[model samples]
Target chain A: MEFILQNLNAQTGSFLAILGAAFGFFLAAMGSSKGVGLAGEAAAGVVSEDPGKFVPCMVLQAMPSTQAIYGFIITIMILGKINANLSLEHGFILLFAALPIGFVGFLSAIYQGRVAAAGINMVAKRPEEMVKGIILASMVEVFAIFALLISILLINNVG
Target chain B: MSKKNETNFLYAVAKIKAIENRLLDKSKIERMLDAYTPEDALKVITEADYGYSVSEVSDAHIYEVLLEEEMQKTIKLLSDISPQKEIFDIFMQKNDYHNVKVLLKAEFLGIEKDENLVETGAIELRKMKMSVKERSFIDFPPILRQAINDSLDTFGRTNDPQSIDLILDQACYKQMLESAKSLNNDFVTGLVKALIDTVNIKMFMRLRALKKNWDFAQRVLLKGGSIDTDVYINNLESPVDSVIELLRYTSYGNVCESGIEDFKNTGSVAALEKLCDNYIMGYVKKAKYLSMGMAPLIAYYVAKETEIKNVRIVMTGKINKLPNEQIKERLRDLYV
Candidate 1:
């Protein structure tokens, strides 16, 4: 235990923690960027047809990326536990766990972004009936939220 | 790949094509027209494949079911293509208006609260009821409240029925323009601008029929549309004898020329409004085809909504046992 502690000191472990968080943030942000960008394209197209529909569509598009922010929080948690007796391998394993959340969350969010954007277009055309579009777009975010929750839970448990 | 897996557009188009087969055709409309009572109409509608049980349905139910299915297909086609939530929100913005109106009307008229309004727009029924009960639009989001407030004076000041409607129309147009400008998308901005232009033309004719002050008419005319407002205004007050009046020439001259003629013949603004809706629907269909990607989707949505409006008109007409000719006249021509 002492040997392990000395080897995994403040320097190496702190660097690993920073690296882990950075990677997690990178993965999550990349997903959000793609998702938001794709959604924006669809929203713009719908707005072109009917400008009144921008708000709800934008809210739906932005909801999925909330996971990426959750991923950031997890990374911050990992960094705080830098010298708190975290095995480098355990820390690394936890870091990888964080990656899937960001990767899957980002991909899922992108698809949802598209759905939400299209949903916006639907709203633009049928202002009389927009609940259906909002519901359909929201359904896409369920899986992404689940993915994010699991990653955050895992990170919390690790600390 | 069989026709199903060929291309997303082909697939969507094919699916829509197949679904169109299930829609109520002309013959069905004829049959519906012949139905004497609401029960008979309901039975005829049930036979149509709109993906819902039409039997035991109310006038609003048929509208809701058809709107839902079309919305589903729209979302299906659009889900993987692009993110257009903001655009969708713009369409839903009217729901907020609808909801607000229902609330206000119910409170003012002492009408029973029906859940029907919930199926209409984005606002939750509970919240909508609360806002209505509160007699204040403040509980809504700032944008919603602003939109509601913007139209209040129009709703309040108009004593004439047609003039009362003009307030809502003007408010809708103004909100749409403001919303479009806020988005910063040239395509959307252009489409919205054109829509406003067409709508303004229609409004101009209506005001003229009412013999309104030209300055008041000018106040309602939104600037930055595709057509020049000054030219349109000059033409609005022009005599019928000078048909070749260069100032009066517009892309909308064809459909609206008839309305202008009708305006002279009967002086009814309703006909002009109907012509405007029909012309705008035609322009939207043309624009959708001209622009690809989400433009088609937007077009499809607009087409579907117009179709729903048409359907509603037919259903309402049928329920009231009105003549088919009158219903047909009220229907907006769609790309279907």
Candidate 2:
């Protein structure tokens, strides 16, 4: 444990900043993958019965993917902020700022995926109600959006 | 259940939702009832994507063929996609028991295989027949083998075909309860208990009507049902009204009261049986809104079974030229 802590302290601030960016991107991407995978599975079931429903089913499946994009944007912002002379404190601040989106995106994406998967059933049974299902699923996006906003604001304010 | 296994039903449940749309609704059933002739009824059924070629043949025999085919299709589809095959097998196990009873009865009677033997059992009808014919119990499941051996032994002693049904019926419920318990799903276990309770009540009412002895009633009574054995046995000598009064405290109390009223008014137990079926259907219908898990799949399977049963009832009534009102009275509630 002492050796690990010594190595971490010896590492450049840019390296710590890169780790923060990686966390933001990787965690959010993971959450999106899980959410989209869940929704895709349900979409496949709908498409198997009626291939004509592919368009709407795909739309429902794509809803959970927004969090990954948000994660990527935060990662890019953090990458842009990193510099050769960046201080360890600034790097740590950026790393802590990444937490909101990392954890929230991870959780919200999974739950959103569940909602989107449930929405796929509406498309299967009643095509006309597809819009309603999508809107209902989108309700889960609010938390992910809030997390993304907080992450962006936090990353921008970091010295 | 494992987390992985729980999530595995997303696709299965979605597919079930799609299939649920094709199930016959109450209005469609009413249309079949209102049809002018059996041929017209067949048209409605064909439009619903069932019995398509069989309807062209227009033979009553083909109707059973169509029903069996539909049942086979449902069982196949569900078995293929279900996360837990054994849970779906609970429904098919009864048919297996039915086949066992038929095969054993045929063997004892020195007769040919009955055409009424349904092929929808978890164990294939042909395989069960072969096992019975060869007098080998190795191929059968433990519960099934034990049931066959016990029924065979009883039949061998008394040479009474009736004893075969009694023994097999008891074994069938016992197996169903065991399977349900193993699945550890509350809905399934509750359903099995409800079924046993229905059978017990039906037997009690029938025996009371026939003025059968307590020993005969006790002989046919199955244990492990929700209703206490003593509740049924204690009411053995009581009047039907008192039996129903005692039942009023149970889940099926209201249905029993109405069924008895219908019986008194019409001199038939058809209403009682229909009520029992509808009660089960009503319980299963709660699963319709569930988007995840095994509930929707089980619900759809039960809905399809009820639809097939209603279709059979409708077609048979039309063939027999029963009045529309009479036919309608006999119809079970639609799950749609």
Candidate 3:
């Protein structure tokens, strides 16, 4: 075990760690980018249609950020492993565990953003109850957050 | 999947983007709001080319058109590229549930048969409405009734119309999730699960307001959803505290804090529900930017629905001569 650990230590282990974090961040960030982009576009449209709804529509359009946050959590974990004393196998486990959130977060954020954008448009049309539109769009975020949180918790405690 | 089929997802995303471009923006909404009367608003809506043409516009007419356009756009997007058959099936199942509820409500209230159905599905609404009126879920067309039996069955002994709706929604969500699970498609699963959680929260609020027994609430509550069942159940038993705890601990904590306060007030169901809408919009905005799949589609649908509801609310308020400030307070937070 010591020999294996010594050999593993001799190798460039940070590559895997950094790769995992970057992958997680990039995957999740790309997903969020698509989602937020859709939402922002929708918000812009809604703003153009009804400027009074700026605040409500803007807030609802921000719901897609959870995916990136989850990615950030994974990136943090991978960094911790890279900087600290850990075995290679343990490092791999941490990396693999982070993939679900990164990928799931990415996908969830995209769809959720469209929904938010749509809701923002709704707010622009009916600025009076912008709050209601926000709630409707925010409802889908629970799942992305759940997926991301589980990934974070698993990476933090398990590996 | 063929090479062409492989790009279906991308194609669908692009198509959605195109559709997104057609929607009315905030300034348009403001313009409509500033109009002198509902007639003026109707003229504005018509001029915007919202895909409706009527000889004379009424509030109900505008409502119908807006909803029809939304459904039409959704179908058009879905049709451009057949996604995983299962995902398509799941989305159709939701429409099926909506049709059922509409049919049931119309029937119970003795509404005019042909007046209420929205024409947006593969099946003709007139034919579906007639078939549904006959009280025959089994004899209904295959496409229309595919997963509906399971949904209806979930209502087993419950006589409450709302409970029936709740059961069907839960069942539809369950089946949808099961189908999504089979695909191993994280995007579809996450989007569907988020939808389920939203439905569950709505049902939970309704049950809380009704003060139904724990068992009844459990029966209506969806199992194996993104939400923790135990936590949801606990929240039902003591909505104010449990809900607060869940909100405080979960990812939705920050956004839902105000909703928790609304629940505390109990008299503030409207405010609480508004908070819930805001929370949902916030969450979806986050999800859409992270991934480029059904999240954006689903979020768009939700926002559209909220928009419809808000318009209806505003029109109603206008008709009733409610104060603008009061109307504003009742409006759900819009996600621009």
Please give me the DockQ of candidate 3 compared with the native complex: 0.03
B252-335 in candidate 1: lDDT tens per residue? 676567776777788776676777777666766654322123345455556666766666677788766788789877767766
**What clash pairs does model 2 have?**
none
Judged by lDDT, which candidate is best?
2
- Pick by TM-score: which candidate is best? 2
Candidate with the greatest DockQ versus the true structure: 2
| lDDT for residue B164 in candidate 3, whole number 0-100 | 56
User: By the TM-score metric, which is better: model 1 or model 3?
Assistant: 3
- lDDT string for model 3 (B1-336, tens) is 232332234334433443454455666666666666766765655665544445445554355566567567656555554354344655565666677777776665677554545565445666677777675656554534654554445444554466656656666677678766765656557666766665667667778778888887777787766777666777776646667677576655653567657766764467656766766666656534422344455555556666666766666666666767777777766645
TM-score for all models, in order of appearance: 0.53, 0.93, 0.57
Q: What is the CA-based DockQ of model 1?
A: 0.02
- DockQ each: 0.02, 0.70, 0.03
> By DockQ thresholds, what CAPRI class is model 3?
incorrect
**Candidate 3 lDDT, tens digit per residue, A1-159?**
988767676343455566677888888889888788777766654565456656876787688977898788778877876654555665666667678777888888877876776566455445676778667766777777777777776667544
Report the Cα lDDT for candidate 1.
Answer: 0.60
Q: Model 3, residue B36: displacement in angstroms?
A: 2.0
